[model samples]
Target: MENKNLIQKSIDTVRVLAADAVQKANSGHPGTPMSLAPLGHVLWSQVMHYNPENPDWANRDRFVLSCGHACMLQYSFLHLTGYKITLDDIKNFRQLHSITPGHPEYGMTPGIEVTTGPLGQGFANGVGMGIAQQYMAARYNKKDYSIFDYKIYTICSDGDLMEGVTAEAASLAGHLGLGNLIYFYDSNQITIEGGTDLAFDEDVSKRFESYGWHVQNLPDINDLDALSEAIKNAQQETGKPSLIKVRSHIGYGSPNKENTAEAHGSPLGKDEIRLVKEKFGFDPDKDFDISSEVSNFYLEAGRKSAENEQKWNELYENYKRAYPELATEYENIISGKFSEEWKEKLPVFDDEKPVATRKASGKVLNAIAEYLPQLVGGSADLSPSTNTVLEAFESFSPKNRDGRNFHFGIREHAMGAVLNGMVLSKYLIPYGATFLIFSDYMRPPLRLASIMKIRQIMVFTHDSIGLGEDGTTHQPVEQLIGLRSVPNMTVIRPADANETAHAWHVAIEHTDGPVALALTRQELPVIDQKKFASAENLEKGAYILSDSEGQPDVILMASGSEVQLILKAQEELKKNNISARVVSMPSWNLFDQQNDEYKEKVFPKAIRTRLAVEAGSTIGWMKYTTDGGDVIGIDRFGESAPADELFKEFGFTVENVVKKATALVSGNK
Candidate 1:
């Protein structure tokens, strides 16, 4: 009991802080934090190694709160430890402009590893972090150097385990033997709606074991010794990820709310808080209470952890001498820069023969894989179809951690989250792929990546009805606009091989957000750089591919496969003695970034009779197509037929485009 008083007091402080913060905010989940306080104290104050002074220390362990609603648990510990967060910040929980938002956000909060509030997202994100640790260890760790040995620790809830993404990530983690990942299931048997018995009841430990994880079930979370031992044992298992299931009361120490849903979401009343504070041996009148003893204990814990980084820094100096090149490369990646010469390795497509943009993307990946070793990825079991394979690399697996190609199976949502987690490492520029139709499954991570402002690539292929024979269910008629709908998300629909190459270049160079390459399965005619504007104009988003002799009567604009149709239609319009300018509008987001002068030059003020033809939804096209202009796009779902047939049926043809241009030119639109 010598150490029990200080540790228990520290855990009790976490509980009271949760209680006080939620009571002040008048909203937010309180019970999960109260219940998991012991786990939080053990993990943050004892088990996890990190210099609170440097939350971003290269080799510091990562902590992901998968049960992000229990963010008070994270926030309380963050404050007590020597992180940037303060008690005042905790008091302002869920308030406007506060770092302590309802859910823990990565960049917003000092200690938060990833922005996680979406259930199960953090669970998958931790798996991605595990993959990153494994990859970095394989890439940088020398025989004696032990660099990149940091582990990923996460706390998930029953709700997290119930989410499908969690299952997908768990299975992949087990398959790859991510022994560095340790997850704690705060099995308080409570959720916001009601008791988990109302919906969820399954053998969670058995399930994780089936997924090949090392499983340990602790009967009580209050038994701090057992929690520490389980974590230690988890670290000892070096071949599989581990899960510790802790049984605990929801609002531990609450007179009436413990083990009840009432405490799970809403704040406990003043009387209840007072009662709990008294029970924990605190001044019953005080709110947001942190006793002197508890504060000193955690402060000392934080100070002691700084030694981990100091030791790692020394080892790093030795590592540099032993592995000079690898050391420089590691430094470059963590600083988020890479050899600019990789740009030269980007293959150029000069052939006039039609080539699928997806195939072009594959060529780009293969051409630069050796030069850009950090550019690692594979498709969601659709590598052959999505063409996301790095041909020269072996699959990343249990035996081969150095492999660049990751077979993320058919789990699209988990793959997106995993990629998010992997990119969290300053070392890997990861990407994932699937059909555009399947992106619906991966929207959470896609949005999270943008929110965190993480730079990664997503190859979304079979972009439109042109994916033929896939039927309406497989074809993505609205996905283009859907992705564009996400703020800060850059969606690039490359018209052909050359444009696709530039899209990848833009994706790598642009560092602010995630870039989705919406590529075509059907072959598109290569736009010759000599005959028209350069494909390099793709960086500008929308460019005048081919122009009219003077101020054209009608302007023709399109993206992806339809660009060829508009080019042909421009000629058709010219044959009819009607002047028309053809514009290749590949990326709306990029084009928006261009100056007004450039936008006006591309869409001249005199050109109101413009026609925008695309194979997908016409939702966001009106910005380019003036009031007098029209858009030829699929307002309905696609059909099961040949790509050519679907294009024709949907009015995505040269004949139809010419007709629309004639009508607009004739003032009949």
Candidate 2:
């Protein structure tokens, strides 16, 4: 490896800058940045096409730090290449809200594409970016007019490959033939505890090759020419994703800490950092020093991207004339604006008979699927069961990139992460579905989506123990409570067909955070909107479906399948001279956000005799039930029985609800 050159000097600056920031903060992983600076320099300077002036450029190449503990490497380069991050900002790394946190946060930092910290999440996100780019190109690009021709480049670590989520995403990317993905596996062979051999010794190259990726292994990270050629070869291979495994020392310049776990985490002391600066031919005393030549070089790199963006803008103007309709649609999608015409397409299910909420959801999805070209998704091999298939379009495949529906196979974890990736730009409305029991497999991505506040739709069917005959293992006794507990996650369990339609409408239009539609497997009778409150009230989370004349002795509240039970109980209570109001509480989070006035209107303080019913956990219902109220929910696991028998066994019958309501009212008396 050449020790003295301008390129080497620029790489050294990145390394030193990262270490100095970590040392100043007395925290963060320092070894990864020190070893990976050469690769970062290559991508930001010569390889990738992105404009620091406008990081949100739609056509720009994306860079994801899958090995997110090495976030300082990205931060240092972001400052050097001028992305609104100044030298002082880098100096304030990991401090209180200084834009440089412990890990890369998506909107908190300008150039960051996604929030990454948990290993393999960013890897899956990069695969999603590749999928999104291919679909966008297939739908929007024309001959000699590449509207969306960008690659998703990523740098992952040994730990990333070890995660199960990475395997799921990698297999999908390979099967899709995502040629736009180029991942560099940083093989330092060192984990926090010790060497990779303690637990991992399998041939990763052979494994990735089996997954159908274009594989290349570089003997040394110092061999810059070899790394460049591998990237070039990866770009040329338009049939598969590429992985280049590069072996490098964890702590490159540190004399004692190099190739050791001591360097992976913890900041180098002042003496060690000063020694590194001296080795890189910088002033040993100057902590955050950068040579003027290197600074000018990266600043020039930033300016050149603006020229590229200028050309893209010019191309887009011409494209508008050539294809007016597509250009307009593209503008609308990019701006996060949608026509209200789709709202008209929402179905009215009152005329229909009893039907499963999942079945009704399928109809509502297909009704407006044509209106929004950006609305596309599939299931985790549960499309038939979850009813998430788009009837009008073909499934997206290696051969059919323009297809709207995605066959994400049986990978729930990857599907959730992929949806997060696709929806990050606000241009694509992506969704993924599976049985409610399997949402446990998707917790990481679900939490990440909420943390990022991105719009992702998760359709979870077979909700509650009512999905019977499959036993307790298949039943989701507490999944609803689990999803409801997550912040920024709106969990809606529609009562019937009409509420299901409204739920889909709200999901499609929601821009703040992810929404989970917990649909039932059993058929539920549609509530007549003409006789009761309009089904459109489902958007408000909780609504009065059926009410007593003026004042009520007791209130019956429920969600999803249990709403029908409460409705029946309301009629039964009325027959007994006990006036009970029926409240369809579809979403607790949404109702919680409502003003006190709205909440009081539904669950008034005067009416303390309230009876709540649901087939999931009873933990969260107590807040709404209050001291004078009672709730009927399955706190224990369910048994293998028919849906009707299970409901009877679990005390979800209308007779049981009537008994509970009468008892609550009598107890208040």
Candidate 3:
């Protein structure tokens, strides 16, 4: 039926191009790409429905290279299939500012589905994409009009399967019955260290099957018909995700390193590459050689994909006329536009009642969820503790694909990666919640989300030592600073119920990067907005909440629950002829973005006597405190006690703040 000779020539083109790119760069893994070339050819030519001309087509199948070290494989496919990736781009692989980086970056490359370098992250991200696909299809698809049916395909390695995050994501994918997910496990049985037998020896096929996946094992990597048939079988089974364990060699044609660990990470020598090219029936002297016939074949495949996209565009037009409202909503979501009035839906909190910031976050989330249909997320089995559950929405499970709330079980690591995947789908505003301390477990995905600059909201409750009785292990002493250290991450610690509501507003509106909301488990007294500055000033990042007469003798600054103590200390200072100003610094990242005039206005260079208070690490307070000021924060781990007692023990009390401010003012004078 198909031209077997042409297909094999195309596969060799992929292999040769990838091996040449890695050999030129001298800094990449070439084995996986060489081994997976046939599979890549089959996917691009026969399976995937992607228009190289319009790589961002909404309904096109998503491909993620989970073994991102083998990114040359994806780069070769992109170049061959005419996705705007030029030959020069492949030649400059891993060079500075090149589109072909060591790993696949979402926005940098046209066809890259997600930014993936860390082993298990892309695997989990594929799960998130599967969830998003199911959600969109369930909500938008009608009878005889399947508008949103796209499969997510990931090529994963042994390292990806061995990671715990992948295990977590695989379990959840099975539980959700994400039939749209079809992953290829490259069973090369070689890690960076040696053979996988040195460490990993479990029956991976049985493992995925036990997790409720449709499992298939292929013994040959070069069998294009078998690979195509397996993919078709995977697509037919519409009740569970499919895992095809492909037994591939590390370096398929290399003479000396075909199945060796040496081929896993390093580039093959020029001589060895020539030998491999010779084995594949190519001229040994040729480098980066691509047959003209293979090039024409892939270009023809791209033309067919473009036709498929044209058909989808026609269907979308008719669907738009039939259901104008739903179509409008869909258009808005795909364009990443939210209603201007969505801000009006934020709830106003009453200052009379004390409320945990987490609880207030829940109310704000539910209130805004009504206006924002794109908002979708869940907690890491801490919905009750983190207060992230959307009360009106049903849980997202195998039975209900349209549900907004997801139960990620106890998988914090997978939750982070999945959130990135959902956001990468370009329609959903995804959020995930867990304790602030456990953010360490999810830092890889969180960092990747920042690097990718996707719209992800990370809600972290039990923020500090104030979350006592669970002791040091549960408390987050340095998590705030750690989150702040990331390049594009916005870490917001809300002072009260009002600020908590505003933080969510900022998170939803701030589309440039990920936002981390650090909330408290203990009830924090809401600042009376009428008496103090309006909570709307929170957009300024740091604002003068309560100022004294004249230039003020000292500035008392804090965030989260400690702001209440600073407010109380201001009253005590006023009684003792001390004019102290209280400043609520909710977000350092936001504050840094402000102009120097605004930053100086909030901190005020005239008032050098400043005292900062927080119930967490004191490392990053010096920037705000300056030379004449000091920070009063916990530098050590917390102890097992009541929250009130812990606050006092950690010197996070009104008395401690007053004493520190008094001494700073005296010394400054």
lDDT of each: 0.90, 0.92, 0.91
Indicate the worst ten consecutive residues by lDDT in candidate 1. 1-10
Better of 2 and 3 by lDDT: 2
Q: lDDT by residue for model 2 over 1-669, one digit each (tens)?
A: 233488899999988998899999999999999999989988888788889989998889999999899999999888889899988899899999799999999889999999999999999999989989998899889998998889999999999999999999999999999999999999999999989999999999999999999999998998888888999999999999999999999989998788999899988888899889889898988888888888988998888866788999999898999999999998898786888878899989756788999999999999999999999999999999999999999989999998999988999999999899998755889999999999999999999999999999999999988888999999999999999999999999999999999999889888778999999899988888889899889999999999999799998899999998988888898999999899999999889989999999999988888889999999989898889998999999999999989999999999999998898888888
- Where model 1 places Cα greater than 4 Å from the true spot, the runs are none
Tens digit of per-residue lDDT, candidate 3, span 506-550: 998888889999999999888898899988878778899999987
lDDT of 1: 0.90
Ranking by lDDT: 2, 3, 1
Best by lDDT: 2
Mind giving the per-residue lDDT tens digits that candidate 1 earns over 1-669? 357777777788889889999999999988989999888888877888888789999889999998888999998888888899988899899999999999989889898999998999999999988998888889888898898899999999999999999999999999999999999998988887888998999999999999999999999998988999999999999999999999989999899999999998999999999999999899988788787788888989998988999999999999899899999988887776778788888887776588899999999889888888788998899999999888888989999999999999999999999999998886788999999999999999999999988887999999999889979999998889999988889999988899999999999777788999999998878888789898999999999999988878888899998899988998888899998898999999999999999999999887788889988889989988979889999899888999888878888878888887887788743
**TM-scores for all candidates?**
0.99, 0.98, 0.98
What is the TM-score of candidate 3? 0.98
TM-score of 2: 0.98
> What value of lDDT does candidate 3 attain over all alpha carbons?
0.91
- For residue 647, model 1's alpha carbon misses the true position, in angstroms, by 1.2
Name every residue pair that clashes in candidate 2: none
Question: What C-alpha lDDT, on a 0 to 100 scale, does residue 133 get in candidate 2?
Answer: 95
Q: After superposition, how far is residue 194 of candidate 1 from its true place, in Å?
A: 1.8
